[model samples]
Target: MMKRVLVFVFTSWAVLHVRAQSFSEVTNLLDSPTVGVFAVGTSIIDVNSDGLLDLYRFQGTFLQQPDGSFLESSGDIGFKNEDGSTAEGSTVFGAIFGDYDNDGYVDAFFEDLTAGSRLFRNRGDGSFYQANQETGIEIFSALQGSVWADFDNDGLLDLFVGGDGDPSGLFLNNGDDTFENASANVGYSPFRNVYGVAAADFDNDGDIDIYLSSCSQFAAASRNMLFRNDGQAGFTDIAPSLGLDDDRGGWAVVWADVNNDGWLDLFVANQPVSGAGIESRPGFNRMYINDGAGGFTDMAP
Candidate 1:
């Protein structure tokens, strides 16, 4: 069993690890020794506005001490509890941090597989309250991952929750601490197993677009989707025309300027035999190069 979580501090070049074996065991720095090792996921945020970054481990939370140590205070802050009770069931697929309410406090959004999807609002006192039902995002699905983006350019971050085999949903910010199921109203319902949901201004059109990494074997469903942002809460699928319709077991997608060409490009990670895939097909990674005209060309073979 994994007894400790290893953490590395990269000091030198991002391309090369100048130091050999720079990892240090943080099993003793955490308050809950068991959770420090068992926590498979984590996020960093300053919940207390103390200028120090705190940690949100899947099992609980850890606040950074002045001396650089960590203290687990999930129960006290209301993010997690001793009984590990969540919104519904105990299985958490993932969690994201965002100040959805514009209250200057970073809130948390969790995606659970069995009706446990919840939005925990930070009360500014190092505590959180479940605001799912009040926010109209008490959604449930065979979830995988989630992302926060300002789809409407309303200065409020919206949410996009992905699913595996189940269709995904996009909740738009209502500017009143509530979210509306814009996917249902806008007819952008995507029924596929989505592993990753990435957002960026790929076209530099001042509006954010979305790239969905999906896993499927069927010809019609296997290809991933790239939704172009058309102003005023509208989106159009332009993945096929851009040649980014990869039909393989997909997992993750990221945007970067790999060649420093002043334009954003995309990199997609795939699995030849993914667990979420329907059929076994040898797949390769794809790097989509932007043509500076809001178009993409798959430069990878």
Candidate 2:
């Protein structure tokens, strides 16, 4: 199934094209804008079931107001950093929102390189507290990728974290606010510098498969990996046979039905950021077309 590369320049069903609109920059902040406190990621979600979306940055949070405006409520919600006046804070590499405890509220997870990862449990009253001791999630590395989904169809969302310099971890929700380390149990505890991760049922097998956009530092390349769920909470590295083991510096991996086919296809962004050592392979983006028969064909031109 050597199909031609399909680039998505527009949506699948689009007729009328419109001109791009311009946006004006907003330079206002609550505390005269504490300058820069290393704002990297933001999660806009309905944190309190108010039907209005709220915002959460690493430095603080911006709660939506009734008048369609944003109010700085980071300090009030207990999510703000300690130093913000003179700009002395670190950056949050990645964050995700999920109600892992089956609660009515959504919780947050933040990954910080210098300060380790943290799990913030939502108090259902617009406030949150760190719950690393309660959830059994304590990872520390150059953390980056984070994804939350009910991969096992267990009715609760599971958590996966990718980081450099150590093996990434996967946490399976125990359905009662606590979690257990499922990385080794699921056969996916790869000791690679994992930067990206995503899940999809590429084979239409009723179970979700995982894709790890992994790359190593210090000249050694880890390549990418795809773990097919065994439907029994187990996984197997089925990357080589599917042409998914591209040794380029895998950064981000995403799968979609590119040709509107029933089977899902994959695309990965590559950019090696190795240390002062020679990279193992050249960095280049890759596209893999699912052949619908437990295999993939590289469709990149």
Q: Pick by TM-score: which candidate is best? A: 1
Highest lDDT model number:
1
lDDT of 2 by residue, 91-179 (tens): 57767888888768888888765667888888988688889898888777667777887777888888878766667788888887788
TM-score of 2: 0.81
lDDT of 1 by residue, 37-113 (tens): 54544678897778899887666788999988889777778865567663323667677888888888888887676
Each candidate structure's count of clashing pairs: 1, 0
lDDT of 2: 0.74
Residue 220's C-alpha lDDT in candidate 1? 64
Worst 10-residue lDDT window, candidate 2: 1-10
Candidate 1 error regions (>4 Å): 1-28, 34-38, 82-89, 217-219, 274-278, 299-301
lDDT of 1 at 205: 69
Give candidate 2 regions above 4 Å deviation.
Answer: 1-37, 81-91, 217-220, 272-276
Report, for every candidate in turn, its global Cα lDDT versus the true structure. 0.76, 0.74
lDDT score, candidate 1, position 159: 92
